[model samples]
Target chain A: MESVGELGESGVLGRVLARMGEARAAVVGPGDDCAVLRVRGDAVVTTDTMIEGPDFRLAWHDGFELGWKLAATNLSDVAAMGAVPTALTLALAVPHDTPVALLERVAEGLDAACRVLAPGCGVIGGDLGRAPVVTAAVTAIGELEGRAPVLRSGARPGDVVAYAGELGLAGLGLSLLFSEAADADGTAHDRTIAELWARHPEVLAAQLAPAPPIPLGPIAARAGACAMMDVSDSLSIDADRLARASGVRVRLETERLEGAFGAQQGVRVPVDAMLTGGEDHGLLAVFPADVELPVGFAAIGSVHEGDGVRLDAAALEPRGWDPYTVRPPGS
Target chain B: MESVGELGESGVLGRVLARMGEARAAVVGPGDDCAVLRVRGDAVVTTDTMIEGPDFRLAWHDGFELGWKLAATNLSDVAAMGAVPTALTLALAVPHDTPVALLERVAEGLDAACRVLAPGCGVIGGDLGRAPVVTAAVTAIGELEGRAPVLRSGARPGDVVAYAGELGLAGLGLSLLFSEAADADGTAHDRTIAELWARHPEVLAAQLAPAPPIPLGPIAARAGACAMMDVSDSLSIDADRLARASGVRVRLETERLEGAFGAQQGVRVPVDAMLTGGEDHGLLAVFPADVELPVGFAAIGSVHEGDGVRLDAAALEPRGWDPYTVRPPGS
Candidate 1:
């Protein structure tokens, strides 16, 4: 089925629709001009697009993984808004030579992602077209359930900075993939690295298919979160963004994150990776100093009356994943 | 700037944010992970994508026109559902070589389109990234306002078929652009074509920057429309889809459509164009037999117990704008 032309656009869409089960939030699903969804109070909408060359490599990721990541990335945005993701719409633009089978795999991956990460959230509608390269735009609709949405600019002085998901593991995994440690001979030194890799397969999964801390968003919101956002870029860069938006200084204790970095034995993880590695899709939030940290969340930093971001009182370089600024290794 | 690379992604986004004034529906607009919107009851969601080569030609359409068409297409979907468009989000994936000014112009066009067609509905959020070609994914959110949504599958036997907005003018204009009538020289005796082009500039505008009858959606629904859809593809093809979905036959009077085609005098508009010309973004509706037609709508056909669409009681071809099946000329 190389090139969806074999099945044609409608055929491919029919197969995709068949794969989708049901969304509880959708009053009416696919086949209509619009998907009618039941909403309470406020509706949350977010959109994210992932392009082939800049966002991923076919050699490193397959259609299933791509589809999962696509859902994760978009759902994470809804989660960051402190809403329950109810429905999703995808617009896929693929090359004329792309396979229909790959799209099915992608659909399966989307279903699997929703099942594991966001149960009851189903893809209700989508648009398919041909492009020179594969690109996907996912629009997620979430309901606030009468709660106020947590904004990035709501953090204040004397707030405790907390995090709920893995930190820098995805970035470290990416580094490992780029490094030559995997190609080494079975020498003692190479064996140490291989053993670490075998023992810590979750690190690889973090990079390939990150299960973001989505549920934590509502928890933090209900717990009186002052400000919140997902850690998509590096911690330092994203922290600086939060600080700039809130007009406060973010001070992180580097020692707190050392535990995650030290999980792998024999192989030393770079401090830069822990500080600036992106694609973690973790929840970073702030709360009042007296507020109790929720389960699965760790107090890592504090907010003070100042500017910029700091790691143990030292200024950290503010750089994160900017598609226009970063180029792929060869390209 | 010649390329978006000059300003970087963030810089471009800042410029775009500056252009968007305010959205009444959005509680939290751009600059956040998700845009929070106010909803009454059921939320209507629709998505559409336009690509460079297949959707438009840079020689004929500019970024502004592309932006307007993009918004028009998505909003029309909302209207077809008998909903009021509330908010919109776009994900633009353009080549790195695309001009930043062009993107700004596109933003302006989006704002202008919203202002003219669906005032008070605004673009609340969007994403920008690099792609091999210029591709845009626009997702529109609408509110049904506590009323039951008009679906395409709701048409019944003995329903009256009505249409609001232009029919084949856009397609005819497209034909004219590709026809020899556009040639500068007045050598041949194609005076009829030249006179038609000189007389009806609105036809070209209808093709390029169509101001669709979006506000009539709620009106038609209040008038007790049973089924509704936006005619994005050829009327014959889309009508057939509606008929098949509803398990009924739509009988369109060629005499009724003749008035639409006759607007372009002296130009022998192809019958095929009238039947199959798409991208007009007109509203087609089915109403109860005794329901009075809306102000802008004219009854053009009738519904009966059958399985396919008919033209003056004759079966029409079951074909329309299927991207996979229809290749652009010369591409």
Candidate 2:
């Protein structure tokens, strides 16, 4: 399996959701870009906290980017609950030496992100504490409008598999970050791709501003998908998860996957990269054979009568993100 | 205004919520016992975090007591929301040196507290992180069957102000902590309030196991409370808040207050302590003239048309918890 942290943030999220224990009121838990909470009869709630060194750092990710990521992450939880986000509460623990404007800009990013991703959801309440580490926890509430929340455990066998939202982009962007390059500012620049990461400055933006295939989760559910999951981790690895949970076998057509990804990036991704790379935050669902999938998804696999996932007819290995675990060359 | 931090955790929460920007989905924001989040339909959501140094110290509060406090504080948020808490998610960050037995004992406390206060809620999901601080964040969700959820903004003039929990007990317990008193086992000895606190031991347990008057939020709301708030800080200080927000004057009947308080402690709290001590986490609400309050609440005073909190027809000076700006008496 890929190193959990290396598969990066979204990958870790996907893997964690797979291991989530069942809780009745959970309605919707981690995975699918956000965790939706069924508040009561009319609203949904969600909260996300970002740590300094583990989630982000001033050294690598700027404060504004951190702010945007924090809001996006929390709001995604509301979305996952099938609820329209309505408000956000922020609790901040910041070091004293940090500039005040930085905090303001962080709030600015939160406001801006709300404007873009959740228009009706505004920043409302929160706490401010002084600490050496800068930690921000955003709690969001949403209105479900009488819709059933989609959950990670709803997947089952005989369901047609489908996905929406881009996969591998954020992971590839992060991989590019380790490259050595420079820009006009005499600082190492970021690239959108690993090869260009050192040559340009967009790489950091992609890593910090991960655009989770947000809307697809509900859309897939609405389309009558039986078993569904988010592809925040590598495709093959997540497929294996679906297979295990649903008591079915997941098969992947490597050629079709290569064509789909190759056409987007103008280069052929290593099979393992498509199989083990993480941070996609895309939706992966299964529906009845008659259901029609929305655009942005290519049918690259299917689930059949079996237990767990397979690729081209074999018992596939577990290859998703695992922070405390080790990884192999391909993984 | 009082230095906000002087009120300790609960006081700080009250002050911050007082200034919480207005929003449509607040249903209940901060203060109270718990934050009721209107999630999907009629569900409520609340969250809280417990830190090692400020919230708990291993050298003082034991693992079970710490866990009980953590659960109590988080559950209090749900109660503040006026919701029947249904579940809880805990994200705990601890140092690698922490023993598994300590973790188990903490879980035991979690179980015990839930059995007492929140039978509907249990420790749900959790994350274990390696850190120097034993950090834990619990996001609790509840349900509000069909009540007009209560909030902090409804106080009206001519209302009777009331409270449903002890004041200054935890703060007094904390004071005993800094005093040069301890039994051989490091646990205070037992029995009388003074012995349990000063001479005996179990009194420290009250400070450790602060069972929030969680049931009062909903009860107060049902009692036609004009404006409801929690008394996390000193009575004088929090009363002033209700007064100011309601655009009214608050007059504390010190004699009656001392009478009721002395019956329990056998000690009349110093005027300074009564005005500045915090961390009671009790419910304070304003009731209409026609409403009769439930048991345990005394009509501390009345709210009249005016501005700011008043005491015996005089401007009450603010002095509560404020970590950064507070100076010890005679300092």
Candidate 3:
């Protein structure tokens, strides 16, 4: 896995895309030029941004990767919403003396990503200026084929809670990066990421690149996902969110999850990570009890009559990484 | 006009958004705690960020405004795209010893903004860490009514180039604070930011608090705007963008611009700032030759078959403010 703070730059995105599922409105998702969504109308608008050190590391990710990631991250959001992404507006703040080439690469990555993921969406406007660190912001819009949207608040009690994307790879990879940073040697190493990284060379890619389920979000929503949300946070946290929004308790069937997801241990984070670790970009969804979901979803949890989070029999703790409560690497 | 960098936190944003036209999708924008867009789909997504030296003034802006602005800025973008923003993800980097109250205010701002804009969006996911300065990245996802989005490149030649928002107040207000770094007097200007600001308080207000035309973008687009763009950059620069993207040149009628624009200038920057300034957040659009534009738009320019820019009859030589070619401020 790429180190949280010192991860390398290139070749991490592909792996992230390989493991992600598809949403309906999204014609394209991660690893593409841009994540394309089908907007209801002809007009499409989009935006993007990059943060200084926290979003990336100068050591592990390169300028180019950061560029691609920044654009990919925002494009994913638009994709998740089922809008046809048409144009992007970038708000960039960087150090005064940053290398021109680095900025160019970042721009290049943005352009390249748009071309691949969502050809319909083009880079139309960008804001560039000086700052102490490099940061970018992007926002994207898409067309929904004139359908009712999919929302997290729409789930109900007895809804079949399912997931259409990878569970905990990013959380696990991020943890590995932090642990490695704490490791005196600091050489990048993650059993799951190494294997996947070599093949796709993009496993930890999930950690850095953030391959969003651009199309799957709308798809799940349209496929009768009563309630749906992107799992950019802890599974337990997001589940709790869905539960709270739907006014129900979510009883995640640990046994079913164990049966279906234990094989990928490296990617399979600690249950705590699975419950609370963030930034996986997966989707947690609730569906009608009887209707079969679209092709990508795996049912591992069910909604119940309760409050907050629960795993097996016990109420889960809100232990996801928090800025006020958690201590990140190199802080 | 506002500077790209000035304005104490939300002040700059307020300036940019002050004169924007409403979109059919936007339930709220900028002035609200959180901006809302009508969602065509069930789910809405959004993002926001805080820049240290630029978006926030270490000497001027407070932590709460920082947080609020971080969330609001991104939410504004979502509104611009005609999406009802839901859920926010943040990435923050700051010194370990940063005051907890400051962070709390930032969170409070986030919470407040969400409560106002998209209660559903709230503080869903975020990453917190350390850096020399404080910076926050927040992304807001919005849902839009089943309508097509408005794009910056959609304007056609011969379309009346009009705007649904004001221009250059942010730049004007920013000028008051631009030289604060070099001011040897070191007067206690930072202590009372409210009073010792610019002469044209409205102009400065535009810089500090931009009025985004949340509803106007989609409206203008649908109203036969050949093209539509947010006036984050100077009207001139952004207009140039429309021209280049549309494969046409724009003839900005300075007299008409003078009659329509607020903040009457003396000798300098009337035309220059109007044309080349940044952060206005106005809409620059082109419409069919005979079509009537929506309310708030006055014809300030026309799109002709040419390359680059023009002011009246003269060839508008860009002063390096083009999206891809702007020189660093100090340079």
Q: Name the candidate that leads on TM-score.
A: 1
Evaluate every candidate with DockQ and list the scores.
0.83, 0.14, 0.13
Candidate 2 local Cα displacement, residue B119, angstroms = 3.2
Per residue, candidate 3 scores C-alpha lDDT tens digits across B1-331 of 3322233324333332332223444433332111334444433333334566545576655555555556556655555554445545455556656665466556766666555544455543334445567766655555545555444455566667776666765565555555442233422146446564544556554555555555565566456665565665466666666676667778888888877773443423466667666665666667788888788778888877777778889887654233223332542
lDDT of 1 by residue, A218-240 (tens): 88899989899999988898899
Candidate 3 segments whose C-alpha is farther than 4 A from its true place: A1-38, A41-50, A63-90, A100-125, A154-157, A183-203, A210-215, A265-273, A321-331, B1-331
Q: Which of 2 and 3 is the better model by TM-score?
A: 2
C-alpha displacement of B255 in model 3, angstroms?
Answer: 7.3
Candidate 3 global TM-score: 0.61
- With a 3 Å backbone cut-off (N, CA, C), the pairs that clash in candidate 1 are A3-A98
Interface RMSD of each: 0.6, 8.8, 9.0
Please list the Cα RMSD from the true structure of every candidate, rounded to 1 decimal place: 5.0, 11.2, 9.5
Looking at model 2, residue B25 earns an lDDT score of 34
For residue A45, what is the lDDT in candidate 1?
92
Q: Which residue runs of candidate 2 sit more than 4 Å off their true CA positions?
A: A1-48, A75-87, A140-144, A181-203, A265-268, A321-331, B1-46, B181-203, B265-268, B322-331
Error of 1 at A31 (Å): 0.6
Model 2 lDDT per residue over B227-318, tens place = 66556556676777666656677766676567656444454466556666666666667788679987767777777777776666677886
Winner by TM-score between candidate 3 and candidate 1: 1
Interface RMSD measured for model 3: 9.0
lDDT of 3 at B172: 54
TM-score of each: 0.91, 0.78, 0.61
Looking at candidate 2 chain B, the ten consecutive residues that score lowest on lDDT are B28-37
